[model samples]
Target: MSTQSVPVLAANDAASYLDLGITLALNNWPALTLAVQSNWGGPTSDDKRAWLCGAISEMLTERPETDAEDLEDVLIQVMNDEFDVVIDDESAAIVAVEIMEMKQHTDRGNFTEIQAMWEAYQLKSQQKSASAAMFKKVDAKDEDQETDDESDEEGEDVEMGDAPALVRAPREKAEPEIDDDGFTMVKKKR
Candidate 1:
């Protein structure tokens, strides 16, 4: 059974349908069997019908608590591997119909569980990104404020410590000279 022949359904549609079918099969066996037999051609040899059966049953019984896409991915893998037999389009259509019928029995509770899990995951992801972005903004603001404060302090220090210009005038005014008092001392020269 080569995998090249099986038709691929759209991601969302396929996931939803598989989830629904599995949900339904778990609740009712006889009905599920009838549904599968009616649509799928009883069972094919050299192909894995068990996965299809199991998927049907589990969907009805367990009703996935997580990603529906994950469950559908499992189904696609099984179909490609275990049931890769080349069949006519009509048979494929029949298989699809059976799957669709099984989907009808999907438990609402399963949907709710899966949906909640997905939503939580998405919310957590959003929160993480938002926090990171906010931190970046805050850090930038802090850096800017620090730069401003540093510049202001440097300016004040420069103004107060400008002694070169003020000290020269004071030193000239306090002219030191040799007076007649027999001592070299600084005097207020007129």
Candidate 2:
């Protein structure tokens, strides 16, 4: 797993980030906003701040499980540079700041591209399995018909053309030959 840090938005600076996060969420730009909120707490300003660093971290993370340290690192960087707002404001402000950073990192490509790739893989896998199963059933049915035909033949040498279903010829066994020099030649049996 890649090491990711949870951003520590100077506890005083978290409020602003939280607001940005909330705005995006309220404005219907919820993909990134909601995702960030998953890491954020649900109720109250204080609880929301605790989840503040996580919301930004999730935006930067490539997968669902991100490194805490990585999240913290990004949070610190965003707060130190792009956002200078104090973190200790009411929880709403902190939520706003998180929303801002989330907006910055959210990419249309990440959502659409990954979704298409996953769907294509699923479709191909399903088609392959369905094809294999169809072939198997056809093979089994053919085998059953051959067995029935063989039983009806009564040990007779059934003509190949007369057989309704195709039956592969059994391999002929080779016999060993005795050489004039008194050496025995081993023949491969099929």
Candidate 3:
């Protein structure tokens, strides 16, 4: 993604960038152990300097505004640059100022925004599922009542009346029960 001329990465993908801190020291930063240890590159003192220079150059091309005073500065800027691309510091150090493999990345601003949107999407999705579940339960209850009504049709012969039947149920009469230990029990009917 592109934002303000800097490429943006999805927030989820960009979390790795934060994990790989720009200041973390690579093998060559301390000494040229590769050439001397494994009989590979980083053999000479100059070779060590070359590796540092190459890393610096990689940082420069990726971020043009990355003006640095020395090797340390380059590392800092590249690690923090918004372009998200850089020299693969995770790779072996060559003791010469040469180009390294470029690793691309997203800027921080875009990543934060994308992360927020992802959270909102998840919340809305949850709410919709809950509402759907509630409606399903109501519909299931209605279907059950309809099945009971169909079975009762065979038992009764309902004679048509002059007036339409009231849809409302007859209200039960309110009565108070006397339990004072001095009254006889009685029942009433209407």
Candidate 4:
């Protein structure tokens, strides 16, 4: 009979996995994704998101007894500080709860949730890339059509009618009166 022993996860390894789970969870977060995609945290929005993941992981690891409420507060504060966003829709709370669950699961060496999140993120990225490609193709076609139209227009002489001459009423020049405060004062025209 052959006996096989399951590999045990070490403390450091578990912490690494927890960090990975936190990163995956943050990446899949719609609010953070949108903020990064839209450059909400300036040009380095992506970097900000990465920093946020690190911060969350560090907080969880350092404070093992941290609850979801604490996590939610961190999320809200970071969003406001880094992305200049105010999250009042309770999405931060939801993300915090998810992260807490991920932390618990990862601590126990169960990475099923993380794996599923990774797969979903990959699928979403692929779909976004496909959509961008399609948009580019359509845009390229539009540019080609515009170029053809411009070429056609270049082959013909365009007749532009004479524009109407602008007419203006002549105004009488008025001398400005100076006040004691060295300010120019003007009387209303009668």
Among all windows of ten consecutive residues in candidate 4, which has the lowest summed lDDT?
A: 1-10
Question: Against the true structure, whose TM-score is highest?
Answer: 4
* Over 4 Å off, model 4: 1-13, 158-190
Model 2 superposed RMSD (Cα): 19.0
Model 4, residue 181: distance off in Å is 29
> What overall lDDT goes with each candidate model?
0.47, 0.45, 0.42, 0.82
TM-score of each prediction = 0.28, 0.28, 0.29, 0.73
Clashing pairs counted in every model: 9, 41, 6, 0
lDDT of 4 by residue, 30-75 (tens): 8888998899999999888888888888888789899999999999
Cα shift from native, residue 121, model 2 (Å): 0.5
lDDT of 2 by residue, 1-190 (tens): 1001223234333333333333333223232234234533223433343354455535544453434445545444443333333333233344344444443434321233223333554576689789999999999999999999888987797466854777899977665678999888976545
Question: lDDT per residue, candidate 3, 1-190, as tens digits?
Answer: 1111223444455433322222122322433333324433323533433444445545555665543234344544433342223445633233122112122232432334333443554576688789999999999999998988978786788987699766988888766577799675577765
Candidate 1 vs. true structure, TM-score: 0.28
As a whole number from 0 to 100, the lDDT of residue 124 in candidate 3 is 62
Local error of candidate 2 at 48, Å?
A: 41
**Candidate 1 at 165: error in angstroms?**
33
Candidate 1: count of backbone clashes, pairs at least 3 residues apart or interchain: 9
**Superior by lDDT: candidate 2 or candidate 4:** 4
Per-residue lDDT for 128 in model 4?
Answer: 84
